[model samples]
Target: MRRASSLIAYAIACCLGWPAQAQDYPAHPIRIIVPTQAGGVSDILSRTFANKVQNATGATVVVENRTGANGVLAADYVAKSTPDGYTVYLGFQGTQSVLPHVEPKLPYDPTRDFAPVVLLATGPAVLVVHPSMPARSVKELVELAKAKPGAYSYASAGFGTTHHLAAEMFKLAAGVDLTGVTYRGAAPANQDVIAGHVPIEFDNLGLAVNNIRSGAVRPLAITAKDRSPLLPDVPTMAEAGYPSVIAQSWFAFFVPAKTPRPAIDWLNRQANEVFSDPAMRDQFLRQGLVLPLGSPEFLGQHVAEETQRWGEVIRKAKITLPN
Candidate 1:
């Protein structure tokens, strides 16, 4: 009886030690690696998360930008970091899925090297046209582009980025040809769009929403089956008669692979809490995000499904890019 009692006590202690030990998680400052440039969506959103994390965990959270190679540089660094939960990467859909599809030689496999913490938010891609363009709706834009293939130039935040892939997918689905012009980031590219230097752009709602409200740019369609709350009147890609062209981009959280499960759980819970917070939700809205929260397992499956979906698009299109 004494031996059995000891064994039971040891089992209970082992289970209790997990999260109790995790209390030491951010013993020092935590570093969040943002895979894009300093001003992009991931950068802004991650910084907001980091600030709230600092308040919740009582540890300073720093955002480090490691740009280039379409976010592979940041992925490689974080994947190689210690699994002590001090380092994490903000994984964007394009950087994780579409870039690998287009470039074909990403340094680290997203599924292999990282563990998802939580799904932060999803930003549906929006098709916006310059005021100078005659198109007022998705069908009209398609008709015009079909009428003059390659005559209308559309700006992309980056080459083979989610926006670019979405545009390609739409073109494939709509059977239209519009030339793509790649830019360093959405802000500048969006600026050009608003200025009418580019005839059209496939942008995330964050960049295009306010401009759209101000009538600086014309919204053609949302890349989703249903209209977005931010743009309720704008028709969905499906409603525009191209249901298959719909695609919504998202951002996810990840720590280096092999981070303890308890730590991952804690982080995910903290993230869900943040997402549920009214202040944080409002903050995300101000930044043009519609915050959607989910568990680590949910985020993992989402990344897996998104990766597979992008793979299907690439395989069907047989997409290739130059170095």
Candidate 2:
């Protein structure tokens, strides 16, 4: 009986030592999983966060790209990971807000399966067309599309991505019929647009800014309430006469549900601090993104509101994806 008690105590102690306690959290290296290819916005931001966190706390931080199903694969992986703080997910509006409504049978619920950490940044998409295209302004593009319904196609990063939804919203609000050409990612979609394989795309401003400035693509209007400073000459959709076509992309951090409150709070504080720096803020603004620092509760509430907002867009646009 004494031996049995000793073995039991040993097992309990080993379990406790595995991750240490929430107070001594991050006893082990933490891994942040991103749902996009490396060199993309998501991957770049995730790596930046990891590097900053490691620098600030001297804790090992790893960023892994687990791409598939337009972020569902990585998100589901993080959802099923240990509830310990070791595994983190950098999820964007598509995975957290839009996918919930688009894919009813998603393996994990964004709200139910993960605990909110922080909302990192947000930005709008730039409405761009190939340089060869005659359209120079949003009005001209609408006129051209109206003249030839279904003759023009726009590149989408994926079926249910922000790129896709933004195009759909434009179609609905502008009363045009432009077919969508889906690509594996924004990089390839923008590449094809630049290559003239596709004439139109609503691309992330960060990704489209260089091409827009290089004259590889013509900037029509941005899908934002205010014109981006990076391309201040470009008008907003509202200013272009489509007040209902506002769409923006946002990114946030989350961990598997049931992670200790202390770990969540620690991560939230660290991320907010890293992004709130003036240098960091200016860096993101130069890239056409805005850093938003807020508590975990703010992220949670934002997710809920965005889900509902996108749900209406999905329903109205009648969007569906293939299995």
TM-score of candidate 2 to 2 decimals: 0.87
Superposed by TM-score, candidate 1 places the C-alpha of residue 15 at a distance from the truth, in angstroms, of 8.7
Clashes of each: 0, 0
Name the lDDT of candidate 2: 0.89
RMSD in Å for all candidates: 4.0, 4.5
lDDT agreement with native, every candidate: 0.82, 0.89
lDDT of residue 176 for candidate 1: 84
Q: Give per-residue CA lDDT, model 1, range 9-125, as digits (tens).
A: 999998888777786766778788998778777888778778888887677889999987767888889999999788989988866777767665677878888998988887788
> How much is 254 displaced in model 2, in angstroms?
0.3
The reply for model 1, stretches above 4 Å from the true place, is 1-20
Measured on C-alpha atoms, candidate 1 has an lDDT of: 0.82
